[model samples]
Structures are given as C-alpha cells and as structure tokens.
Target: METGIYLIVTIVNKGWGDTVLEASMKAGAEGGTILLGRGVGIHEKQTILGISIEPEKEVVLSVTYPDKKDAILQEIVRAAELKKPGAGIAFVVPIAQVAGVVHLFHQGSQSNSEETK
Candidate 1:
C-alpha cells in the first residue's frame, strides 16, 4: 500500500462509454470503471414553461501511475470530445493508498514511461 497513485476522472456523453475506454487504454491505462450519472450545470436546463432539464452522463474512472495519468486523461478528453458543450469534464486525483498490487504498480510505472517515449 502506498500513497501517490493517480486516478483519472472522466465524465463524458452518455453514449461515449466505449470511446472513453478505448482512449484511456490507448493512452496507457490498464483498465477502467464506468458509472452512470446526471450532469448539472448553468446551461443544463430547458425553458419549457419554466421547466428545468438535465442531461444524463457517463463517468469513467481510470486509476494509473502518477506519470501516465496526464496522458490518459488527455486521451479521454480528446476522444470523449469534452471540448464541445454537454460533453462533460475530466480531472485527476492523487491516491493515498492502494492494496494487492505492489508488483503491478512497478510494472505500470515502467510501462507508462515506455509509452510516453
């Protein structure tokens, strides 16, 4: 168990789940998890008789090396088309501890470096 692992938070369009996964993998993520959610923002509303509307979303979580996290996040952003409206957002968090994967962490770091080259 160690602190300093990187976690990527990617929120994308509802139907872009597969695209996010492919992008993260291509950018050096071993794997990822997805969760369904709803987006709430200033522009996330409709004016139908003063009614409000919010769009559904998909949140993709990829935990990787501190080094690879950036590239993985970038890939998700690009692939998910987050630059467009309603595409969602992405970020990274530093993990304080993890278990059952000491060796894998080392391997992930090595692979991350290699991929960046």
Candidate 2:
C-alpha cells in the first residue's frame, strides 16, 4: 500500500496543548496525543534580568493525510502564535508505514490506497 502519511509535532507552553488540538481539529485533523514535559533551553540556566527557571511545555503529536497536513499545521501555528520567537515550534516528518488506525477512517475513502489517513 502506498500513501502519503505525515506526522506533525508541535511543542508549546504547558497550557497550550488544547489550543493546538482545537485549531488542528477545525482544520481537518481527527485527533492527537499530548505529552507533558520540562524543557531546558541553551539559555535555560541563564538569568533573565537575574532570574533562572525551568519551563514546562506540552507536546502535541498529530497524524494526517498529505492533503490535510499543510492546513492543519497552519492552523496550529496561528492558534499557537508561533511566529514570534520563543512562542514554540513545529515540524513535520513522513511515516512510511502505520497500523492500528485502519478502523478510524470511513470505508468509502479506502478505495484509494495511495492516501489513507
């Protein structure tokens, strides 16, 4: 089977996981998984005006069809306001094979084996 499968990973402030999910869903994403984490940047140990802190962040992992990848990514970016520095960052990677999600899609859409979600 040949398909265009893409995994979108978005990282943002701890409280922004739902925001990303909502935005993505509106833009055609079915669902995603959220993970909580603590991040240490290169400047994490540095003092900002004499203050140091460890920041907590949320990671959202979404998988989608190729046709919906760009729209979903853009919505997440807009909702997260990631254009500004330090807001957050997102990237995409392709998946060569996938399983356990075959039941989530509608039957009519399964005809084209080239782009199953």
Candidate 1 residue lDDT tens string, 24-110: 999999888889988675556665677766678888888887788888888888988888886788898887656655554566556
TM-score winner: 2
Model 1 TM-score relative to the real fold: 0.77
Clash number for each model: 0, 0
Q: How well does candidate 2 score on lDDT at residue 43?
A: 37
Where model 2 places Cα greater than 4 Å from the true spot, the runs are 42-52, 104-117
* Residue 63 of model 1, lDDT score: 83
Clashing pairs in 1: none
| Model 2 weakest 10-residue run by lDDT | 105-114
TM-score of structure candidate 2: 0.78
